[model samples]
Target: MAGTYHKDESNTVNRYKHQATYDVDTIHAIVNSTPVLHVSFVPDTSVPVPVVLPMIGQIGHYPSDSESHCYLHGYVSSRLMNLAASPPGIPLCVAATKVDGFVLTLTPNTHNYNYRSAILHGHGTVVSSDEEKLWAMQLVTNSVVPERYENSRVPPDNAEMQSTQILKMRIESASGKVREGVPEDERKDMKRDDVLDSVWTGVIPVYEKLGEPVGGPYNRVKEVPEHVRRFVDGENARRWTYAVEASRKPAPVKRVKKQNQVE
Candidate 1:
């Protein structure tokens, strides 16, 4: 959807309004591209402390659904599964981040990382419908490698389905922030020839590199599958391209919120 997510107290950008985005496509893109999403929720109301889990998740629309939803693959913790199964669901936060480059500045205070980050706040409930569950399962499986569900033994067995679980999160609010550029230094340092001569200012481009695939002991496939080969090669190129591009852009200006910076 081209429509943007509504900004409210819950989703407002406090400081970096210039880099913050409420666009639906931008937020979804950041989430989908990240390898792992950190899902956090309060496990016990009495304790009021949140539990964070590194989970595999993807966002997409189901055939029968009116809007897109976030689906999480949760085969790890039974406590999280139980909490997500209740009616009306539990409050959850999902965060994804990709560090593109490291911005090294003249001073430590201005040092930062070029990155893309997204946060989604939603109510997550167990996917009870078998048909929807199946679709979500496939949605998550292919997220790792394109067309993976079709390329492998799929239509999960009954036992596999029974053991696995999928949590559907109806997003209430979402937002994203992006930082890309070389380095930013205060005028005080920029004018100092000594600091300029001694300090190095540049960006170290960072990207995830996919290594050669190794087959498991039981795997009898003669060569790497087409889907696997394509995804690995394509992702490596895309990742490097983005990191380098982001590294070359003009440095971003700081817009710190008043009364927030400590002495």
Candidate 2:
């Protein structure tokens, strides 16, 4: 699994190399965990600067057990979507990150954050076939609001489908960087009596939680559906536990042995 992605100059982490991960599971988890992904792309060759848009997308294999791609949606006439229509595809970078805690160290220099982030670089092509396009659309819609596609009207009307466009990017290379556990203060600072007595250092658990849901007007449902309620509760509990655990301590190191027990 580690060899699935070969790290290169584009995906390698220059600083804090130990925190970098090329594992498929780690990269996929980080990418799918975040709600919004920032896609940076050049609209036209004539323009010098690239445009960054907050897009809702999902990372998945479409049609069947094929290569992984990041699926993004936007208006039909949008510049980004239009750019994806080019031959071969449009070059773009996609990024997603989640913050778990804020590490408050004794000295400001050592302060850091517990986070998980993934960056995917690839060429995005506009999905032309209606069959594949619908698959990608449903994947993205469910990601935004779980079970939304099945609950609401699906197989969108012809007009609606014509107005919306989906771009599928064939991910070439990807990497994930994660920081967990508590703060690491310098040895000199930790040994200082004055600093130990005066300063307090620890991680402040930070997590994004889903608040109580509110129904809108013209709504016939009297109570929040069980599905929605379960989703909220499950997410809140999972994230909160992750933040708390990440701030507390590191996991126990695993030991590996040689086949012949050379030692």
Candidate 3:
């Protein structure tokens, strides 16, 4: 057991405790699986509302370390990026969610969705060093479409780099919650023969299916790029399989053995 991440008061999961996981690997996977992350921050205390924005980002770690940091890129003059770049940086919360299936039950009260979600609390600090900024920018670009950075162009030109700013967020705490398997009905509902006969109860598997690529009119490439083609096919297949299995079977609950007191 690599030590578990500390659960701070704010991140402690209060509902469905069994669905909560503080494991770093589980939390990272959930964050990476979602395409876009929603970032929320209060620009100023005087302002009544917080601002939320959809952003593209990725999680990565240093070669010698297990801890991870999130990298995000935006226009140099954007409001959010400017605020994050200010001294001490701005406090932000990042959230990502992926819905696997819609659990339909005989009773309205028992209905719920099978999904995976993660929340990360961090301070958004700008990446200043040129080398690190380039690396982080490349990471974010590739995240949108794998291998896209290399396939399209080499290192970005000076103007492009100058216009873009990258933020390296230091994660303070994180939590992940996942729900899977078929609908769970109450004993009373299951025992009622009439209810069972009249209502259809099961999971309606849901997945984000990628469509075929349609290139632009000016596109010179004769065929769709191999990397792009593979990504679409691969993602669709993975989601389809996960949805099918989760619809029928229960997720396996893992039990960990306790370490010996004297070990």
Candidate 4:
């Protein structure tokens, strides 16, 4: 049965949906469960853009029937595979982390944190089907931003579509772990006045903020995009809104060194 993943009003998980740390089978199960994969790529040369969107589509499967080799789908593009086949090992590492909560403890020793994270290490192969490519693009966008595709323009053309290459990696090894609760020392420090009176003693909440929006090239007619406007008015929206506004301001110039300094 597919487990339901839900977030509370605070965006924190009240219950764990899955735990597949020790069992390889379980890990594979979770990997195959999701259509979207968050990938991190590292390139050999420093370029204007290091991350290249490879072929899209479901190009591979992990833990093959023999349980020995994972099969990657897609045309064998030398450029794409060469990066994956590099001597040092994988050129990229991809993973995801979810912040659980701030643990408040009576004593410093009892202080702790809670989080759930998954790290996937492996090489990726490009996937080549046109039908799959479209699906993959939809999956990737929706994964990061829900309903994003519904509001955005479709890919302009086939060449434009083909420009993006998708890569699939077999999950060779992976792990997921979590920690939760108050510090163990709470019992010993329960009676300490200093511990009780310190204003900063409890867990200080953390939140994501959206800030005001800056007008764009089309601002002459259209109001700020709803996406941008929503953040400005939403609770805990200041961070993003403020960042957008800051980006519009001119950047500070760096000072140059004098020609004759004691050398």
Candidate 5:
């Protein structure tokens, strides 16, 4: 939920103490907005580095009975040696994309998606705490399957934690950009028969769906656990309903009214 940091008039980077906005709502929206995040980092040394890495981690609450908050954890490189080149305080950029609608225009270049996306640039430090690392692993599980921790077995010891490396990024600058509506060329292109017919055009919506849960291998009881049943009926249902409602809501109107007009 880090707020967008504006450059000072003098053009120097501000410290973390400056008045900044990191609203919970903004952070939640950014976390759920996209399922995939593209993470990029620079090696501390002058050697050339790869520009992109695909990160698949859940950003959600811890498993224990507590208020849910956002936590991000995932393995960067499988090879332990790759971690050496990464600096302690260097900034890493994480970006997410949520395609809400499509923009079909008269020209091919104008085609785009109506999306809500977030780009966060910040420095991440390698986690060395035993307790924090265990909590991070639990957070990852809960992110993927809400309330899965309660139904599953707890992580026993530090050996598992030691195997995984966690990084906590202090989010410095974040920006959210969104676009939604019918195509910009809807009015003009509708009038042109050739332009309209040449392209098969319309909006194709995307959504996440939860299928029926399978029983765990170790479960003695044959029936699905109550937690699994409740999750399917509760959170998953609500999310889909909310997404549909958001899609149906009319885009904000920006018409201007004449001054002193009462009509």
Candidate 6:
């Protein structure tokens, strides 16, 4: 809320200037709350093609570091690890989006989504420090489900530690856009007698709802663990409440597009 990311050409929002935010806290919140993040990078492959990988990541503030960086992990990406370990690290882009509701308008072109999105640009380096890596591993684990790391197997053993690699992407800039509220249409459409009578307009709430826990085959515990149950219940309630509330907010002011701008 207090510290904001400096806006620059790379992170500036030209189109919905009103919804764009460079707030550090807001960007972190959007990323942390989203279940998955898409990280894109270029690899030195024979063909040299861009790769977009879905990863589990969270922004963390370590006591040793002056600024926060996103810790990344996924099904072992050895190539990315190698790139990160190289001098100066590898350039990376991380994006996350959470859909709150679907805005239905009189016409299809006016339909839109209520959402929060963030884009981060940075260079990622492999976290070589064992202490920091361990801490980051725990941080990512808990991000998925609170207290999951501590509840699971204690400090990772030699094999686990050796096999896992975590990346610290020192964020250079971040930009976020948030869209909420109900349906909005042009004045012409709003005043149309025939069109207005024929069409339905409103917002349909959307959210990621966690279902009842199903125990694994090897799970001998009779009842669901307190942590697991708590996370399921808590996430469902929070996500649903936000979605419904967003659907009820006042619609965003419809702006007239410039003659040169395309819809």
Off by over 4 Å in 4: 1-81, 85-93, 104-109, 180-200, 211-215, 219-263
- The sequence of per-residue lDDT tens digits that candidate 2 reaches over residues 116-148 is 999999999888888888888889888866887
For 105-217, candidate 4 gives per-residue lDDT tens digits of: 66556564444455455566554566655666665554434456665777647785767655556545555544433323444466777767772443333334444656666
Tell me how far candidate 5 lies from the true structure as C-alpha RMSD in angstroms.
7.8
TM-score of each: 0.94, 0.90, 0.89, 0.49, 0.69, 0.93
Which residue window of length 10 is worst by lDDT in model 5? 11-20
Once model 3 is optimally superposed onto the true structure by TM-score, how far is the C-alpha of residue 94 displaced, in angstroms? 0.3
lDDT of each: 0.90, 0.83, 0.81, 0.46, 0.58, 0.90
* Native-referenced Cα lDDT, model 1: 0.90
- Runs in model 1 deviating more than 4 A are 253-263
Candidate number with the higher lDDT (3 or 4) = 3
Q: Positional deviation of 83 in candidate 1, in angstroms?
A: 2.6
In model 3, the worst 10-residue window by lDDT is: 254-263
What digit string (tens of lDDT, one per residue) describes model 1 on residues 1-263?
A: 78899999899887767788899999999999887999999988789798899989999999778999999986647777687778788889999999999999999898989999999999999888888889988888899999999988878899988887888899999999999997988888999999999999999999999999999999999899999999999999999999999999997766655695532
**Model 4, position 186: C-alpha lDDT score:** 41
**Candidate 5 segments exceeding 4 Å error:** 1-24, 57-71, 78-88, 103-107, 186-201, 216-219, 246-263
Model 4, residue 111: distance off in Å is 3.3
TM-score-best of 2 and 3: 2
Q: Give the lDDT of residue 175 in candidate 1.
A: 95
User: Model 1: what TM-score?
Assistant: 0.94
